[model samples]
Target: MNIVVIGAGLTGANAVEELRNQGYAGDITLIGAEPHLPYERPPLSKGLLLGTAEPGSVFAHDHDWYADHQVDLRLGSPVTELDLGRRRVGVTGTQIAYDRLLLATGASPRRLPLAEPSNPDVVYLRTLDDALRLRARLTGHILIIGAGWIGLEVAAAARQADATVTVVEAGSLPLLGVLGPELAPLFVGLHREHGVDLRLSTTVDSLTGTQVDLSDGTRIHADTVLVGIGAKPEDQLAAQAGLATDNGVLVDARLRTSDPHVCAAGDVANHDHPRLRRLRVEHWDNAIQQGKHAARTMLGDDTPYVRQPYFFTDQYDLGMEYVGHVGHAGYDEVVIRGDADTRVLTAFWIRDNEVRAGMHLNDWDAIDPIRSLVEQGTTDLDALRDPEAALPVPSG
Candidate 1:
């Protein structure tokens, strides 16, 4: 089989690796737009950005892995045309035919119109190169827009570097849209307690050079301005190929596109989930699992992709892992399992008297049981709520 995977990020690399491991000996070609080998992006905002991790530690595979596995690794070659009809992809002057194709094309950070492209002081973090450049500039006063995950993480890194950090978020809480009102306060207090001058419920009116004017008529000067206002899916190729795209390339429970021969994974796949509504996840776990799922589907596996959404973040002294999705339907109540006063706890988002989602902060022991509750569903809300009660709650 002549299989071609567009994208050399975490998804594509893992997908190709899975194919080899599954004992499918075929002509596999992995295409990448970036010159570098497939690498992980999480460290860009964490260890790499904080200068604690080695530069070469983020790559997904070694240089010889592709050759040893007989996978044609094409770097710096982007697919200019995705011709699903012809079952061929156009890369520069050549067209590569494929029996099966996987679009692991990931997402890019949102661009700010106010931030000039020529200005080095204004920046956005998405790639490894971007992280390296921003790490060296985490000095003096750092002004960040959007109190999203990326924004909050950079703020934490800046504070650790002894640089004054001010994060301006338009929402009432730091992660209002994601965590909602029930749990957003935890993050707001986390950043504020660690010396981040959080400007919540406010927007930037204008960006003039290094000075920013706020909607509240406050003016602030900044040494560097970092915009972490979330990211959008890179689904232009799928759209141009006449595939369904809403927020991202729409895929079914099997990760298959409108065309059966084509599949999309990672950040670009707007999955029609079995448990949840149509959603797209941009986390590291989703990318890895979905990539493997997409590859298996190409091999004629009928199993559905039903893994709940998962993501983790490390900011200040807090480390949190979240499972499941509440969606726009919202939650009925939030149950806590530790000292709410202190910086340690396990929280569960309950809906319709069922566990829809759960998260833990600085508590690793509760993760396995939390995952069980989110996936298997729990009947005992009383025992689940009790911090003293053992999890997976003793079902009679």
Candidate 2:
């Protein structure tokens, strides 16, 4: 059997590895648009931006691992066309035929409209090269236009590098969309405590020669501007191939696309999740788990991709691990254990008296039990909000 994976990111790399690990004696071709090996992207905004992590430490596998495993790894090859009828893909004047194909093409950072497009100081973080370039310019006054995870994380890194940092957000609080108005203030305090000049309920009106004009008739001078608004999935290849797409390539519970021979995972896949209905996740853990699951499905595994959603982030003294599917689910009440003022707590999102999701900040030991609570659909709010209350074990 011949398999071609059209991405070399974390998801694509894991798919190839799982295929080989499952003892599939087939021709596997892994193609990546970037010149570098498959590397983890979470570090790009944190450790890599702070210059604390080594360049090679983030790679999924070493360079020689591909050759030793008998996998054809192609770098710097972008698939320009996908021929579903011919069962082939066009990559820079070359054609490769495949019996099965997995599309792990990830996402790209959303670009903002700036008056000066030629300004070298304006940047966006997405890849290793982008991180490296941003790192080099982390010595001056840095202005970040967005209060999302990426924007806040880069602010943390910039502050750590002794750079004067400012974050501008149109919302009243940082991370308001993700964590809601109640919990978003915690992050607002976190950045403010770390000496970040956070301007809330504000927007960047224009950027002209390092002077950023704001919507509230104010201007801030900056040496470098990093835009972290959000990202859009790279699903053009799948859409062009006649695959069903809605925000991303639509896939079933098994990660199978519209065409049986084609599948998608990672950020590009809008999967029909078991508990969350249809959702598209753009996190590190989702990429790894979905990639492996997609590979297993290709190898005749019938198990549905039902792993609970998980993601984490580190900024200054705050380290958080969240597990749940609450992006769209409406939760009635939020239960909290410990003190939010102290910045060490475990919070649960409850809907219909059932725990839908939970997050731990500066508390590492609660993840497993918190995950168990969410999975078991615990409805005891009193016990959940009590730090001393024992968590119930899952019944077989």
Candidate 3:
């Protein structure tokens, strides 16, 4: 059988490696738009941006890794169209046949509708090229719009780069949409402690030259303006191929798209969760695990993607680790494992006296037990809340 996996992000790369590991000896093709080989992306905003890691350190595997695995690696060639009827993909101008196709094409940065499109000062980061461009333009007084993870991360990197940074968020607080309003200030404090001029509950009315017009009739001067308002999934090809789509290309619990021959994964594919049901995740762990599952399924394995989504972010001195969706409506209380002001804590979102989600800072030992409780839905709130209690036993 011939397999083609589009997009060379973490998901696609992991899928290819997993296929080989799973003893799939059939022909395989991995198509990637970027000229670079499969590389890790989380470092783009952290280590790579901060100059702590060398340019070559972020790749998942070197160029020769693909050839050794006997996989056809198509770098710098982007698929423009998907012909489902003929089971072919239009890459650049050529069409390639595939017995089974995996759509892992990741997301792209959102372009703001600018009143003045001529200004070349606004920048967005998603790929290596975007990071390189942003790095070159980093100068004094950088103003970033949005306080999401990317915005906050860039702010951290910009400050480390010795550029005066300011982040403006339209929400009441930074990361409220993701981490909840209560926990948002922790990140806000993280930025402010580093001397970032964080402006919450504000919006930029317009951008003219180096000045940003504010909704409050104020103007801020910026040497560089970055918008990290989040990204939309690249589902055009899947949708055009008549696949089901919501926020992303919709797939079933098995990661199989509407078309049986097509499977999807990563940020682009929104698949049903085996345990959570009807839920879709866009986290790093989800992408890697789901990609592997999709590849196995394509190789005729009947396994469903069942890994609980996980993600982490490192900013300044804080290390955040999260599991499951925190603070679901059914969750009635949160158990704080440690004092928030001390910069060390683990917050367990409790629902019906069971641990639903776990968030920890500098507490690595607490994650596994809490994760077990979350997965099994049998956490004892009383024992968990007790600091003296031993870590909960792993459930069956």
Candidate 4:
């Protein structure tokens, strides 16, 4: 059997590795748009931007690893055409046939009309190459539009670099939709404490030259302007191939697409999660675990990808790990544990005594229990918010 993976990001790499681990000796090919080998993206926003991690450290496998595994690794050229009916993909003017194809194409940065790519001063971060370009321009006054994860992380990196950073967000708090109102203020205070000129409920009216005019009629000068609103899934090839797509390439519980031979994972897959409904998760853990899951599904494993959604962030002194799923106004109660002043706390998003999701700030050890809490609702209502309470909370 011939297997081809479209993408060389963390998801693709992990999928290929999983195939090999599963003893699939059939021919395999991994295609990537970037020249660099498959690497993790978390560092692009965290340690790499902060200059604390080396460039080579983000890669999942070295060049020799692919060769040792006898995997045909294709880099730099993107697959432009996908003909699922004929089971062939056009790559660099060449057609490659595959018995099974995995679309781990990932996602692209959400572009803005005001921030033109032709403008050298304006930038966006998504890949290793993008991060490198943005890193070089981290100095001078940095004006970032959007208070999302990328924006806040870049703000933290710029402030640490002694660059005057001003962040403008249309929302009241950073990650308001994800974190919700109760725990959202903590992040607002964090960035403000770090000397970031964060303007909430504001947006960029215009990005002309080095000056950014705000909707509130305030203007800020910038040497480097980054637009980090969010990203849209790169499912054009899947869509063009006539595969089902909405927000991303739609996949079932086992990560199988509408067409049986074609499958998708990573940020490109809008999975029909059994427990959490239909959603797309763009995170390190999801990429790693779901990539493996998709590979197994391709190998005839009917096991559903039942893992809960998880993600983490490190900004200034605040480090957070969030588990499970909830929306902007999805939860009924926000229960918090530990000390708020010391910045060590665990917060739960609860709906009728059921823990929909949970997060911990600067409390690394709280993740497992948070997972357990999401899995098992607390027996005693008071135990949900008690750090001293034993884990799993013993459901009635």
lDDT by residue (208-306, candidate 1, tens digit) is 888999998999999999998889999999999999999999999999999989999999999999988699999999999999999999999989899
User: For residues 266-294, could you state the per-residue lDDT of candidate 2 as single tens digits?
Assistant: 99999998877898999999999999999
Model 3: colliding residue pairs: none
Question: What range of 10 consecutive residues in model 1 has the weakest lDDT sum?
Answer: 387-396
User: After best superposition, candidate 1 residue 191: deviation in angstroms?
Assistant: 1.4
- Rank candidates by lDDT, best first: 1, 2, 4, 3
How close to the true structure is residue 375 of candidate 4, measured as C-alpha lDDT? 67
Steric clash count of candidate 4: 0
lDDT by residue for model 4 (1-396), tens: 999999999999999999999999999999999999999999998899888987899999999999999999999989989999999989999999999999999999889888766899888899887888888888999999899989999999889989999999999888889888877888888888889888999988888887889999998889999999899999988988899999999999999999999889999999998878799999999999999999999999999897889999998878999999885338888888888777898888888677889889998998987888786754466756566875545443
Cα deviation of 20 in candidate 2 (Å)?
Answer: 0.7
Minimum summed lDDT over a 10-residue window in model 3 is located at 325-334
TM-scores for candidates 1 onward, in order: 0.98, 0.97, 0.95, 0.97
Model 3: lDDT of residue 42? 80
Native-vs-model 4 lDDT?
A: 0.90
| Model 3, span 1-396: residue lDDT tens | 899999988899999999999999999999998998877778877888877877699888888899999989999998898999899999988998999999998888777675255677888878877777787766799999988888988898998888999898898898775566557778888899999999878898988887899776779999888988888899998888888899898888889999999999999988787766666666678778888999989988887777677888878778888887643364677777787886688777767667677778888787787677778766666788897886575646
How accurate locally, in lDDT, is each candidate?
0.91, 0.90, 0.83, 0.90
Candidate 2 stretches with Cα past 4 Å from truth are 393-396
Candidate 4 displacement at residue 119 in angstroms: 0.4
**Model 3, stretches more than 4 Å misplaced?**
115-118, 327-330
